[model samples]
Target: MSPTNNKKAMCRYAGAQNQNVQRTALPEIIDRIVNSLDDPECFAHIGEEPIHFSTSVREMIEKFRNILFPGYFSDAKIDSVNVSYHMGQEITRLYDILSRQIIHVLRHDCLRYDRECSECERRGNEAAFCVIEQIPVLRQKLAADVRAAYDGDPAAKSHDEIIFSYPGLYAITVHRIANILHQRSIPKLPRIMSELAHSLTGIDIHPGATIGERFVIDHGTGIVIGETSVIGDNVRIYQNVTIGALSLPKDAGEKLRWAKRHPTIEDDVIIYSGATVLGGDTVIGARSVVGGNVWLTRSIPADTKIFMEEPRLIIKNQPKETDSEGN
Candidate 1:
């Protein structure tokens, strides 16, 4: 090799060596940080068996999505000729991935909480099968959701557009799947699924929320549907809406575990943007319309339209620009 090339390679090797030395110099700090993880409250599980991997969970979700909507999210050609074969293959793959993840979650909980052995492997397989069996019903519900979005939004060009690009639909899709697991009382996994959707769509929907069919969320960013929220069929809500619980004390988590803390929107209701409806006793009755920026805490009767009084505006034009005195 040429002398110049050899010298440049030597310099690169020296720089890498120097970086390694600098990284190793932090041994004391690294030891302190590792020791700090001994705190029981810390989220780290040092020396314990590894928990369910988020990447694996995400892959399972994607496979499930492909199963739910064939040919939409996948690269493979799905038609009448090979659709059944494709579906069967994808379902079997999803079942494998999902069962493994379920085992990890159940085992982690069993060990972490000092709980009795629940035969995590068997239960995981059963849960995976259960979720798989309900895909047909889930597909029906998703079809209704897609139709609702297309029917409700004027800008929606087609059902295909809504399914492919709408964040609201994506959030709802994840929520529906997560809700099934939540109903089965599968711990950790459901919340993880919901949070994955939340992270992607900027929509926070708790898996515990009971949302009915034909439900629509338009421009769903900044929307929070809390645990125990009961949303009825054909309900539509817009962006920045919060169907949440009233404020509670520090021990609310324990105190309100099974409590119906969030508001209920009856069937055929429409809640517009920036509305906040809070409290367990608060129910927006059937066919009601809640206007934007309305902070509601109490129950309202059916067919009620709640809107804020129009604010008076004071418009003053800026002083006309003055030309130079000579002009």
Candidate 2:
């Protein structure tokens, strides 16, 4: 087509349509969509607050990080002089946001049973205080994690480098904070905390996982620790490692919800990149090394090394094809 005709064709498609069609069709579409939500399968409720408010949860995590690592991941200026003052302020702010979120989760659970909870506010306060009390312990655990990362990785320069720039450290820190609330059986908020870390770092550690001190995830990404997983001290895991469930029980009752489904890693083990260790019965014993891309489903004794054999590769050059006439 000619340039003039193409421009004319484009101009013909550039204007607004009929007002009556949009005005009539939009409300009808909305009504159809909204009315459809009344079906039994659809889950829109008429009167209820959110199960968990994500904005509040995010704020709680932010303040938690700020407290866990002062002057790192925080907006406030910190020094030895005013450390106590800043810590108090950050904890107060975090408690306010977290308590409200705990209350929201409690109310949501009560809503499912069509009951109004009078104790939600009190319980929320108690839960928040429990987590607040764990801050010092979480810091202690996180310091071990930071030290592990700095000591394990040859590329690490300083403690400040590991604290400020490592994704693994950040995810582990989030998990430590979330694990405290998870252990307290405060519903919904723990998962939210872990998920926020998953969004930022590609590490998917369940809040229910029991991880010990001096843990390091080197160049961490695609690492999944299942809900019932247990990891012992001085363990180091590389990127793309999955310590997950082999199979979930079928037709199991609610009693089996918290049953162990993931593997256990003992102390001083090193899991290299792209390794998958599955099944709750499977254990990596102390001082073991699992090499890259190894798929394991069975337990190994202590002081073992697992690696794949070297595969042979052939080198070949592409042959240029001649034209149809053999030119």
Candidate with best lDDT: 1
lDDT of 1: 0.92
- Which parts of model 2 are misplaced by more than 4 Å? 1-14, 18-20, 115-118, 249-255, 317-327
Q: For residues 1-327, could you state the per-residue lDDT of candidate 2 as single tens digits?
A: 999999987776653345555776898899999889889977776677666657777777788889888888877678999988988888898889888888888888887767867488899999899989888888899998998898878899999999888999989988988888888888878899899899999999999999999999998889999999999999999999999988655765575677888999999999999999998899999999999999999999999999988679999999989999997
How good is model 2 by TM-score? 0.89
Instruction: Tell me, by TM-score, which candidate is best.
Output: 1
Write candidate 1's Cα lDDT for 54-122 as tens digits: 787789889988988888999999899999899999999999998888888888888877899989999
User: Global CA lDDT of candidate 2, please?
Assistant: 0.88
Model 1 clash tally? 0
